[model samples]
Target: MAVKEFKLPDVGEGVAEGELVSWLVAPGDRVEEDQPVAEVETDKALVEVPSSYDGTVEELFVEEGEMVPVGDVIISFRVDEEGEADETGEADAVDEAGDETAAAAESEAAADEASAEPGTADAEPEPAAADAEPETPSGRTFAPPSARRLARELGVDLAAVDGSGPGGRVTEADVRAHAAGDAGGADAGGAESDEAPAPTPTDVGSGDRKSAVRKRGEDGSGDAPEPAGRDTTLATPATRKLARDRGVDVDDVPTDETRDGEAFVTGEHVRAYADALESAAATASTGGGSAEPTPEPEPVDVGADAEPAASDAAGDAEPAPAGATEAGGDETSAPESGDETVPYRGVRRTIGKQMERSKFTAPHVTHHDTAEVDALVAAREELKPTAAERGVKLTYMPFVMKAIVAGLKEHPYLNSELREDEEEIVLKKEYNLGIAVATDAGLMVPVVDDVDEKGLFELAEEVRDLAARARDRSLKPAEMKGGTFTVTNFGAVGGEFATPIINYPETAILGLGAIEERPVVRERDGTSEVVPAPTLPLSLSIDHRVVDGAVAAEFANTVMEHLETPLLLLNE
Candidate 1:
C-alpha cells in the first residue's frame, strides 16, 4: 500500500487560501474520489473540498478553523495496489492525530517484537507509563500541551478545568467547557492511572481562530454565559465579520433557518442582533423609545464614505469600536459598562483590501442624470401578465440590465478591463453584468453571465435567483466573478443620484435611483404642455483613468435612451 497526498484546491478564482471550516470525513474513513472531505470557507464562499483519490483517509494535516492556503497538502490517503477505497469504513469521531500517531508507533513496535519472537503474535504489549501522561513531582494538573494552549486561548485556568482523560489528565474539551462557562465550576480531579491516552485538540474542534465577545442575555441584559462557538451556525465569513464589526457575537446571533443541516446566519441576522442591542440600550435610557418606530435609529449607511451620525435627540448611541488605543500607550479603548469587544477579520477584511486597491488604483468620476420612464413603466405593466405566464416576476431591473448592456455596446470602454501589468485596455465583447445585492450589513454582487444574449424574462429570473442566493450566502464563487460591468439599484432602498464605486477591473458601475413621478414640459401639437412623468434617476460612475468624461456621458445617454424608448432594448 502507498499513500497519496491531497492539497486544498482553489475554491474560487483568484482565491489564495481558505479556512478549514470543518472536516466532513475523519481519518481511517473510506473516501471515494471526488468525495467532499471538508468544508472550507474561502474569501468568496463556503465550499466543500473534494478528495482527489479514492482511499482510506490516513491523516488530516490541518485542524478545523485553521486557514489553509491553496496548493498546501491538507490530507493524505492510504491506497492499495488496485487504488480503491478501504473496505472497512469504520471511524472514530473522537480520534485525533495524537492517538493515530501513538497507534501507528505501537503497531511498528509490535511488528518488530513479532519478528524477534515467532510465537508472540497474539501477545499484548506491556503498558508504557513514560509514554503516557508523564507524572510531575509538583501537584500540577497533568494536561497535554494542546490542552494548555487551548486553556490559554480560551482564558481558562487549567487548574479549574476538570480532567476527563485517562489518569485524570485534562483534555482540550475540558478546557473548552470551562471557558464556555459550563454549569458547576471545574475542580482538579483525583489522579487515576489508566492505559488509554487523552484525546487531542483535533477531537475538541478548537484551532487558531482566537477572539472573544461577551454575549448578553436574550432580552439584551443581565449576566450571561460566555460565548462559545456554535457548531450549527453556518454563515459566510463576511456575515461573521459584520457581526464582529457591529460588536455582536456570531454564536449568539439567533437563526431560524438552516442550510445543509446547519443554522445559517446571514448579515441580516447580525444587523438585527446589533439593532436589538442598541434598541435595548435606548429603551433602558429612555422610558419607551424602542417601542416607537420613529425613535429607532435609521440603519447606518455602510458605504465607504459613510460617517458617524447621531440622529436621536439623546445623542451618541453608537458604541465606538474597541482596541483603539493612543500610540505607545499601554491603555487600550475599553468597552463601557455594557459593551462588547469584536474582532475584525475574514471576508470583510478581504473586501476592504479590494475596495482600497480599486479606489487607490483608479480615480472615480460619477455623472448623474434622470430618464423619463413613463412609456417604459407602461410597457412593463403590459408585459407583467405575459411574464407571469412564464413564471417570472418581472421587475424594472431586467430593463435596466438590458439598457446597461445596450449602453456598453455603444461605449465599449465601459465593458473593458484595465490590465496595468500588460499596459492594455481589454475590451470585452461578451456582456456580463454584476447585480449588487445589499445585505443588512454587507453587500454581494453576483454576476449574470452573457446578459447580451438573455431575454427579458430570462434575465429577470436569473437576476432574481442570483440576488436571493446572494442575500442568503448561497451564491457560488463563480457567480460573483468575471463581471464586465455592474448595476447597483440604490433605488430599492431609498437613494437619489448617489455616487457609486466602480467594480474593480471593470471600467464602470451604474447606480439606479428610486423611480418617482415628476412634473415635466413636453411638446403637444407644437406647443409646450405641463405633464406628470415617471422619471428614473441614473448615476453612472466610471474609472476616470481609462474612460473619458465625454464617453461616460454618452454611455449614460445611451442607457437613458434605451430606458426611455423601451422598445429599443428588443432590437439590441
Candidate 2:
C-alpha cells in the first residue's frame, strides 16, 4: 500500500487560499478519482475540491473552518497496489479463521457493528466488542475533536446522534443533521418556562452546573428528578446574541424539532417567541382580546411596477460608516444598550478591499448627461410583442447594452483595460460587458461575453438569466471574470446618476438611471413648441489617466445619439 498526500490546487483566478467549509468524505472511506471530497470558500464563493486519486482516505490534514493555502497538503490517502490484500480479503480471512465460533453473537450485534470501518469488518469479535465500549446504550458519545467543536458551536448533543464514522465516532454530518432538525421545530411554539421544565443537564458540555441530586424511593423504583435548565437548544453564538437583543431567553423558546431524543432551538424560534411576547404586551396595554395579523401586500406586474426592485438587486453600495450622521444631518449615536458589532468578512470584506484599491489607484472623472430617448421607448413598445413571442422578457437593459456596444465601436478606448505595470493599454476586440447584480449577500458582476456579436433579444435573455443566477449565488467564478467594461443600473431603484467606482482593471463603467418623462422645447417650422418627452439619465465614470475629457464626452454623446434615434442602432 502507498500513502499519498493531496494538496489544494489553485482553483483559478489567482486565488491564494481557501477556507475549508466541510468534508464530504470521512477517514477510512474509499473515494474515486475526480469525486468531490471537500467544499472550500475563496473570493466569497464556495467551490468543491475533487479527489486526485482513487484510494481510501487516511486522514484529513485541515479541519473545517481553517484556511489552507494553495499547494498545501489538505488530505492523505492510502492507495492499494496490485496483488495486495484488500480490506475485503482481510475481513474474509478473519471470518474463515473464526468459523462458527462467533457467528451466533454476530447477528445480534449486527446493528452496533455496522458502524465499524470496512477494514475492520472481519476483525476478531473481541476487538469489535472493545470498540463498542465507548458508546453506551444510555447515550454516551465519542467524536473527533473537529466534530466536538462543531457540535458545541451548533449547540448539538453529540450523544443523541448515531455515529456513522469508523469505530462508532460521530461525524460532522450527524451534527449538522441534528441541528437542521432542531431549527425546524425544537422551538416551534413559544412555551413559557412555567409550562416546561427548567434547563437541565444537556450533552452540550459542562458549562452550567446542576444542583439537583436524584433520590429514589425505599423500593428504589421512583423516576429521578430532572435538572434545572435541562432543555435542549441548538443555537450559534450570533443566534444567542440576537435572542438577547430581543430580550428573549433561549430556554423559554418552544420548538417542535426533537430528533435522537433531544430538542433544538434556532434564531427563528427566538424571534417568534419575542414577537409573540410583544403582541401580548400590546394587547394587554390596550385592553384588547386579540390583535389582527399583519396584511400582505397585493401582487403587481414586477417588470413594470417593480423598477426599484431591479436597482436594489443591481448595486452594492458601501455600507455607511458606523456612527455617521443621517440624511437630515443629525449625528447618529450608538444604542443605549450597546453597539451591535458585525464582522466585516466574506463578501463585504472583498468589496471593501476592491473599492479601496480602485478608488486609490484610478483617478476617477465622471461625466453626467441626459438623452431624449422618446424614440427608444417607442421602439421598445413596438418590439415588445415580438420579443415576448420569442420567449424573451426584453427590458431597457438590452437596448442600453446594444447602444453602449455601438458607442464603444466609435470610442474604442472605453472598451479597453489599462495595465499600469506594463505601461500599456489593451483594447479588447470582443465586447464582454459585466453587469452589476445586487444580491442579499453582496454585489456580484456576471460578465456577458461577445455582446457585440449578439442581438438585442439575445442580450436581454442573457442579462436576465445572469442576474437571476447571481441573485441566487449560483454563478461560477469563470462567469464573473474577463470583463472589458461594466454597466451599473442604479436608476432601476430610482437614482438619477451616481459616480460609480470602476470595476478594477476595467477602464470605465456606465451608470444608467431610471427613464422618466418631462417637458421639453422643440422647434418645428421655425416655431418653438413645448411637449413632454422621455428622458434617460446617464453617468459615465472613466479612468482619467487613460481617457481624456473630450474622449469621454464624445463617447457619451455617441451613446445618446443611439438612444435618441433607436433605428441608428441597426446600422451599427
Candidate 3:
C-alpha cells in the first residue's frame, strides 16, 4: 500500500490559513474521494475540507483547533496498489525507519511490563520520569506541545476536555473548548482514566459552535460554589481585566458555557451579568420599598443568527459603530459594568477599517439642504396601484434614485472618482447606484447596475428586490460591487443630515434624512405665503480634494430641483 498525503486547499480570497475546527475521519477509517474529512474556519466563513483520494486513513498530520496554512499536508491515506517491485535506496531508508519505529515500540512495551511487575515499585525510573510531565494525563489527552502551552496560559485543565482529534487525542480546539467551558468535559470519574474516543464523521453533527459560558444563578446574585482546588471562572485575560476594572468580581459573572454542570464565564457574560445587576439595583433604588418586584432586563438580540453579507474589498477599512471610541477616547478607565465590548470581527471589522480609511484619506465636506418632495410623493402614490398590479411594492427610494441620476447627468463630477496615483479624474458613464440597507448584522450596500437605463417601474422593482435581499443577506458579492456612487436613506431609520463618510474610491455619498411636513415660505403672485410642505432632508458629503464647495452646492441644488419636480426626470 502506498501512503498519499492530502493538503489543505485554498478556500477563498484573503484566507491564508484556517483553524481546523473538527476532524471527520480518523486512522483506519475508509474515506471516499471528495468526502469531507474536516471542518475549517476562515475569516470569510466556515467550510468543510474534502479528501482528494479514496483510501484508508493512515494518519492526520495536523490536529484540530490548530491553524493550517494553505497547501500544507493535513492527512495521509494508505492506498491500495497492484504491484510493488522497487527495492531501491529509498525503500531501504524507509525499511530502516520502520525498524527503528518497531524497536521504539518494543522499548515502550518492555517499560510498561516492567512498571506493572509485582513487587517492582522502583524498577522503572525512565517510565516514571516520562509520566511526571505536566499536563500529560495518564489515560489520554494526547495534545501537542503547543496545546499544552496554551492550556497553561489560559489556566485550562487538559484532562477535562473531550478530544476530537485522531485516536481521541486532545487538540488545540479541545483546550480552547475547555477554557470556554463547552468541551463537554468528561464525567468526574472518567476524567483521569479511560480513553475517550473521538466522534466519527457519522456520529458528529453540524452546528456544534462554541457558546459563551453562562453565569451562575437565575438572577445572578446567589453565591456560587467554587470548583475544588481550581479557578471557577474561565475567561480570557481581557475579560479578567474588564471585570477588575469594573470593580466586579469575576466569580459573579455567568456564561452559557458549562461543563461538569458548572458555569464558566467569558468577557461577554461578565458584561451581561453586570449590566443586569446594575439594572436591578437601579429599579430597586427607584421603587424605594414599593413592594413591586424588580423587572428583569429585556434581552438584547446580538444578531447571532444573522447571515453574513458579501466580503469587502481588500485594503478597505472595517467600519466602526457610530460614537465608537475614536483615537483620542479615554484609555485608562475600565469599561463600565453596563458597557459591552463588541469585538470588531466579520462585517463590523470590515466597516471599521473602511470608515477609518475613508475619513482619513478623503477630505470630507458635507452640505445640508432640504427638498420639497410633495410632487415626488404624489407621483409614487399615483404609480403605486400599477406597481402593485405587477406584484411589486414601490417606495420613494426609486423616485429619489432616478432624481439623483438625472442630477448626476446634469453635473457629472459627482459621478466621478479621483485617481490620485494616476493624476487624473475618471468620470463614470454608467450609473451603478449603491443602495444602503440596514440589516440585522450591519449596514449593507447592494448596488443596482445601469439605473439610468431602466425605467421607473423597473427601478422600483429592482430596488425593492435588492433591499429585501440585502436585509436577508442573500446578496452576491458582484451585486455589491462596481458602484459609481452610494445613497444612504437614514430617514428610513429616523435620522437626519448625517455627514456620511464616502465609500472610498467613490467620490461622494448622499444621505437622505426623514421626510416630514413642515412650514415653508412660498411666493404667490409676488407675495410671500406660509404653507406646510412635505420636505425631505438631504446631506451631501463630497471629496473636497476633487470637487469644490461651489460645485457641490450646485450639484445639491440640481438634485433638489429634480426631487421637487420629479416629472422632469423623463426629460433625460
Number of the predicted model whose TM-score against the real structure is largest: 1
> Distance from true position, residue 350, model 1, in Å?
2.9
Q: What is the TM-score of each candidate against the true structure?
A: 0.58, 0.57, 0.53
Assess candidate 1 and give its lDDT: 0.64
486-531, model 3: which lDDT tens digit per residue?
A: 9999998797679998998899899999989988999999999999
Score each candidate by Cα lDDT: 0.64, 0.64, 0.62
Q: Report the lDDT tens digits of candidate 1 across residue range 1-572.
A: 44566788878888887877788865446789899999887778668888888766655655566566687667767555453221211111112212344433453433333212111122242112112322221333656544655554333555557889876778898888776784332221312111112322221121211111112232223211223347558766556656665655677676654556676665555544554455454443445433323233333323223332323333334432221112211112233344544334446556677788888888999999999999899999999999999899999999999998888988899999999999999999999999989864267789999988989999999998998887776778878888999999999999788988888988999999999888888999999999998899999989998999999999999999999999999977
Flag regions of model 3 displaced more than 4 Å.
1-339
Residue-pair clashes per prediction, in order, are 0, 18, 23
Give lDDT tens digits, candidate 2, residues 16-84: 777677888765567999999998877756678999999766556566655566776677666665743
Cα deviation in Å at residue 518, candidate 1? 3.3
Model 1: how far is 417 from its true place, Å? 2.6
**Reference-based lDDT, residue 46, model 2:** 69
Worst lDDT run of 10 residues, candidate 1, spans 88-97
Candidate 3 overall Cα lDDT vs. reference? Answer: 0.62
Q: Which stretches of candidate 2 lie over 4 Å from their true place?
A: 1-5, 22-32, 53-64, 73-146, 150-346, 523-531
Q: Give the TM-score of candidate 1.
A: 0.58
